[model samples]
Target: MMGDTGRRRRSGPRQAAWEFFGAELKNRREEADLTQAELGMRVFVSGGYIGQFEQAIRKPQLDVAQRLDHILQTDGFFERMWRKLIKDSPYADYFAAAAELEALATQICEFAPTVVPGLLQTAPYARAVTIATNPLAADEYVEEKVAARLERAHILKDATRPVYWAILHEGVLRLPVGGRATMAEQLDHIAALMRTRTVLVQVLPNEEGAHAALGGMMTLMEFEDAPPTAYAEALLSGNLLDDPALVKRVQATYDLIRAAALSPEASLALVESAAEDYRRCASTT
Candidate 1:
């Protein structure tokens, strides 16, 4: 019965379940005499974003769901739904635990030797990565994943201040994804964020070969009141390491990687020039 009957309506998620969830959110907020804007203010998302949550156009991460539950006094309804939602996502199985921590992280340090880190990915770049990684997935399913991947960055933009420090290998700049235009745009976006102090990016030059972090990507996240954890991911498998020893080793490796990387200023210059080169090539093509 809730299927699209008009141009404005968009179909997404498990229809009946999301409807139940969204309805309860609206009802509870109304019961508390709070507008969507007011609820969003408390929830640390935008008013329009709250509307999207109602329509299930976006899915909330576990921590965001908890925040919403606390703000709306929904008795863990959103958190319950978030659990189910995570079980149904198309991403690597082990990444969900890490994603939850990322939402609450006060600081994030990442070393990406192969590709752009997920949080800094643009829409086109993310879609390209997903399609390449999931070659057999249905179009609709892939779109769902792409949308979710983009949503992960919302935490960094929200009221909770998280310092993001990224160490990217020089190869990440040369290896083009989604073609030259998209890669160029992606680099420009990173530069813009750096200029605004939204993120700190350093590039590890190619000549720094045979380093401690030779392969794979890792992210170290820190919370205000919790011990830090590290996440490392391969093509289809990932691990969340919480043991203080393993995480400490990873953290030390990352520190060395940062030391080997170009300074932030030099990294920004390289990124800008590489982007310009890509843009030029794309224009010619």
Candidate 2:
């Protein structure tokens, strides 16, 4: 686990490159049917070090990548890819950190009031929301952000990863993004995710009224080796709070809000009903 200062310092193209390289290395080793210990022997690194690199828990030096490429007989494949993969992605630095943390988290809980959380948004909804807020962003930039957000969903289905829980405001389901059809599809997607045992989806209805988190959306991420962190983002900026007191305060607020929300079963019914309403509206049009 990265220290708060280490996390702040390690956000950028360099980290992205390392994450990419780590994933690639893991894939290659598995394809070659080599254990971590065997791979470590070939690469001249310890098995524990190899495990850390694969988990993106540690960044490998350039020399390490070169050594691994030669020993693995990949002919500098990883080294060459590392140079090309470091180009800046459209996501903000904080978002990149959040993405990495989200991937590795043991559990995640989110409270969203305005819009659907990124992990649950459909492509069209995500694109429309991004373009509306970031009007100046290039088409490619919007696409990249949408793609990154959607990629986080993979963790939910990954058997080895942690469970995910999200609580969204009723208004999010009511908001008609990209038209009724798109909104219906988004609701359908959320409903589908709810069916997974590892995911819990709840909704705080408008009738619930004035809950503790009237402020804004926040995500609490708990990891195995590190203390929990709370992340909040706005139009152009984001803050990651690791101070124990602040995290606890935000977490307490989230707990209160979750208590006010409909139970998971009730939330599923609400989402399904809303989707039905959207479908009806779409049919009429």
Candidate 3:
């Protein structure tokens, strides 16, 4: 058996739910006499993925959970657990609250001053950044974070995913977060995302100096079914702002920041250039 580590054993209400979820899934699957591989085939995911679910290292998509509930004859048990898992905070309370809102947002406008936005981060880049922030973090904790961050990207595949708009500071392009190779891959991923037309990224040039959101980062989420919300972050802590006035203020500042940043086409050019620069550095070193 694997030792407790990473987000699997991370403490929080959400962590407990995930533990229970794994136990319940394991019991139900075994009672049905289905091996992990057998269950994976029925769910159309890999056996390894099923194992992750059983270990509570990763949570399944809602559709996946529903299908599992069906296959295991759990009668909506998985579905209910899935809901609780998503609604609960996976990170800090405020950060997780914003994440939950992001899942349902119709439009996600983000302003990142220091680094690449989490949703836009590649696996290596995300892992490196997480480790850098918490140098003492256990390897398992880091792996769990990488899993969670990558999982956020899955939202992009959803047909109903919100329009993703991000403005990145120029420093983000210059700083080599995970050294040359990782940063190269990171920039390549962002450039590719821009070409895909699902995301719009604008770069705030160093020449442009400071903008409306200079000291911190902000994510503004607009929802068709509910009131809009905003989140601000610095370091490990963040806040989810539900006040109408505060949300509006942040939205307006974002608009100003966007206006000051380079156009999407131009930003893509810079991103591509930065990627090549990293690749070049990697080759020489």
Q: lDDT for each of the candidates? A: 0.79, 0.78, 0.80
Over 79-170, each residue of candidate 3 has an lDDT whose tens digit, in order, gives: 98777665554454447646655765678989888889989999999999999988999999898888888888877766556699999998
Measured with C-alpha atoms, the lDDT of residue 66 in candidate 1 is: 98
Give the Å shift of residue 30 in candidate 1: 35
Which portions of model 2 miss their true places by more than 4 Å?
1-87
Off by over 4 Å in 1: 1-85, 212-215
> Which whole-number lDDT from 0 to 100 does residue 41 have in model 1?
90
In order of appearance, the predictions have TM-scores of 0.70, 0.70, 0.69
The clash numbers for all candidates, in the given order, read 0, 0, 0
Error of 1 at 122 (Å): 0.3
Q: How accurate locally is residue 99 in candidate 3, as Cα lDDT from 0 to 100? A: 69
Task: State which candidate, 2 or 3, has the greater TM-score.
Answer: 2
Candidate 1 structure quality by residue, lDDT tens digits, 190-250: 9998998899999999889666355579999876545677888887778777668899998
